[model samples]
Target: MHINPYGEDPVRLALDLINDPPGSASELGRRCAAAGLVIDVPPGAADLAETNRFLAAWLGVVDAPDETARAERLNALLAQAAAYPRLTNHAADGWHLHYRDPDRPLAAALRALISVGTALHLSGRGMHRLGRCAAAGCERPFADLSRTGRQRYCSPACANRDAVRRHRNRTAADHG
Candidate 1:
């Protein structure tokens, strides 16, 4: 049923924010809008700082050593966000459930969305669906949204680069 909306877009947004953090509150707002989030508060310096703190913790979930540790870290985040789900149709066209209260500040809303979205992603997709890039020298985080759930790099560029590096090494080893 595409029940998650691909982790309901929040996971990808979280990743984007982590990988390339916004330099300013305005930029953050623009990026959130680009990602389809309806920000209730205009992003501010405090929002930027809070989001940074949240991402720092969220990255921990990405780098967790095992499923148990990962769950533990994510649980911490969920507890901090701690909001009851309520249905709303702010757009007035379609109604959907929201994990946070109505008209929350960007930072507070992000806390709920990223935490809850990540929980859904890990549970719905797989515990191993989040990780750092497999490409050597690139430690960026990635959410494995692949149909096969075998993704190893944050982007196609990293994957191709790693493949090329492997091929070159193999060729050199064969000649040596």
Candidate 2:
């Protein structure tokens, strides 16, 4: 069965691309395929550029001042990639919903996929679920898909580093 491709997977893929973008379209295609976004059209130079542009705009949603601003930014993305939802077995896997027209290149597909997926993620989870890491030295963006929705760091390593730093500072102050 074909798993739904428009939720957490797309958000994670967006974060991966935003954090460390592919240097070439081939790499982008490879990464997307790995992330369960196997589109019909292969990624090319144009797709690479378009994906980079989309991610730049998406980052604004991550860094918005508040939920109102965040919703506004995400709405713009949804508007740009707007397509009537339709069902198809275009890939011959099974019938499923798509937010964009079929046979579009990787960039066009990603635009719709990421935007809608993010909307579902934030609306389904919480607007506060997307943000930069709370760790002092790292401001990297992340989508908090955790069950508790209290994610504040980009990764476990960052969480550990920040915790250690906090503990050391507290100990030094207490001893002083």
Candidate 3:
């Protein structure tokens, strides 16, 4: 089945990239392809640099102090990235909406996808959906795609570690 590529996938991709960034443009391209993105052009050094810059800006949005600040930062990113939507069947998989101009570099296309997807995700879910993990000493970023919208950790390991720490602290307090 054909899913909209501009929604959760891109946001998730952004989160993955942020959490463990690609080492090079080739790695970035490989990761994006693995994430189901169709890369029509080969990624290069410029794409890597641009993608790093874009992710830094996106992290600014994720770490924004409030909804208003987040919205402002996101707006700036959208302005810099997205264009009018167009219909395309680039891979012949099926016709889909593209939020960027055709034949752009991998980095440019990724910027648009991430920006638009993040906007959709935040607005459709909640402005507070994107954030740092609440596990103490592990502040990695995550996109809260959980059904309950109460995710507080970046991964199961982090959550379990934090929970164990809390239990130990409570036990120590009781003994003391």
Candidate 4:
């Protein structure tokens, strides 16, 4: 039995979707497949729209002002998405637990996966392990799965850019 690390992958997938949303159903399917999700069914236009909506709601949890508010928003998502855990060996993969019903649409499956994964990530890691990038102009969402869990920017480029900006500002202040 292979235990799936639901926490990391789903959160990463959510971030990917948020950062570069799919333009169409086929694009959505391709992106999810590229992200290693099993494409049980070909997603349609409705799925694409639903996924966009779901991501918007998920962002609410990410943007929550406080831990209590974050937990509350996440709980609402879990309530809407998650189901009783069940073991399945779909696609000839080893038995693994699923938090959603079988044969669900792509959007629905993503909803469940992301909600449960976020819960596990928050509980196992830390409540502050997820947020938007700290760069002055980039508010992209990022999951802090780093070894030190101090990830503030979405990418190293953003971090470096912010560092350069701060250094230039300090240099100007000193000159003035």
**TM-score for every candidate vs. truth?**
0.96, 0.94, 0.95, 0.94
Which tens-of-lDDT digit does each residue in 89-165 have in candidate 1?
98676898889987878999899999999999999888999999999999999999889999999999999999999
Tens-digit lDDT string for candidate 4 (1-176):
23336899999999999998889999999999988788777899999999999999999999999999999999999999968999988968788888998888999999999999999998888899899999998999999987687999999999999999999999999999
| Cα shift from native, residue 109, model 1 (Å) | 0.4
Candidate 2 lDDT at 11 equals 91
Candidate 1 vs. true structure, TM-score: 0.96
Error of 3 at 56 (Å): 0.4
Best by TM-score: 1
lDDT of 1: 0.90
Q: Please give the CA lDDT of all the candidate structures.
A: 0.90, 0.91, 0.91, 0.91
How many clashes would you count in candidate 3? 0
lDDT of 3 by residue, 93-163 (tens): 99988899888999999999999999988888889989998898888999888878899898999999999
Candidate 1 wrong stretches, greater than 4 Å? 1-3, 6-8
lDDT of 3 at 110: 95
